[model samples]
Target: MKNILVLCTGNSCRSQMAHGFLNQQLGDQAAIYSAGIETHGLNPGAVATMQRAGLDITSHTSNHVDEYAGIDWDFIITVCDHAYENCPFIPAPNAQRLHHNFYDPSKFEGSEKDTRAAFDKARDEIKAYVTDFASTHF
Candidate 1:
């Protein structure tokens, strides 16, 4: 099975959404994990966003990139520039690294509707990318 890791500044939002989408799309075809350069726990907005799309990430946990040091990954994807720029060295010798900055919904603090919209937009973006990634890679 392909081993894939989705990384971001925090394990809270984008990466978590990507992890859920990839896992939902790829199923048993891959082993998926999401981590952060610094763990910021899970984002409720992210969980709710995925739930609206019928994917639940409520059980997911925030993780440090160092946690998966032993796994030989097939892909290492960064969903934000912060993680991409500041990522710690990982021993995934054969992993293909991909980068895409997904908007952070938590940063949008205007109103509940606006925040939800941001999360929804990000969810759609992540889902599209993941569907294509799974189709091409898995």
Candidate 2:
């Protein structure tokens, strides 16, 4: 099974959503994990968005990228630009490093409903990317 790690700046939003999408899409065929350059616990907006999609990430806690040291991953994908810039070094040979920067929905300044819409949009984008990858390769 290919191991995939999703990374973001705070480990609270983008990376966590990517982890849920990958696990949901690929199931046991791919092992998935997520971390951040710095830990900031779970984002409430992120948890709410995932739960709305019928995925529960309540037990998922934020973690630093260093927590993944020595773990071999086939792919390391950064889901946000800040994470791409702050990524930790992974020593796995042949590991493919990729970046697909999605705007942080949490940074959107708007009404409550509007902010939720942004989160939903971001979640859908992640789902599309993951679905394509899983269907073709995993």
Candidate 3:
């Protein structure tokens, strides 16, 4: 099975969401992992957002990219620009590098309704991207 890595600035939001979507879409075709340049713990908003979409990411943890240094990655996808630009060089020689700058819902400061909407928007965008990625790649 192929190994895919989803990366973000902090493993709290976008990368975690993409991990959930990719796992749902790819199934046994690929092994999906998510990490960050720095760990910020799992975001509660992210878990709740994914729950509404029928995907469970509550068991997921915030991991640093170094944790998987020994594995060979088939693809390394960055879900945010900060990660894409600041990520250290991962020694995945054969891995295809992909990037998308998803908005940070965590940065949204507003009412509860607006905050949820922000997370929902980010989740939908990530879902669409990962769905197409699964179809095209796997």
lDDT of 2 by residue, 1-138 (tens): 988889999999989998998988888898898999999999999999999999999989898888888888898989998888767677878888878998799889999999999999999998888888778776
**Model 3 C-alpha RMSD to native:** 0.5
lDDT (10s digit) by residue, model 1, range 6-58: 99998999999999988888889899999999999998999999999998888
Q: Model 2 Cα displacement at 120 (Å)?
A: 0.4
Best by TM-score: 3
Reference-based lDDT, each prediction: 0.91, 0.89, 0.95
Model 1: which residue pairs collide?
Answer: none
For candidate 1, what is the lDDT?
0.91
Candidate 1 has what TM-score?
0.97
Candidate 3 Cα deviation (angstroms), residue 25: 0.5
Worst 10-residue lDDT window for candidate 2 reads 83-92
Which is the better candidate, 1 or 2, if ranked by lDDT? 1
Global lDDT of model 2:
0.89
| Cα lDDT tens digits for candidate 3, 1-138 | 999999999899999999999989988999999999999999999999999999999999999999998899999999999999999999989999999999999999999999999999999999999988988887
Q: Which ten residues in a row have the lowest lDDT in candidate 1?
A: 102-111
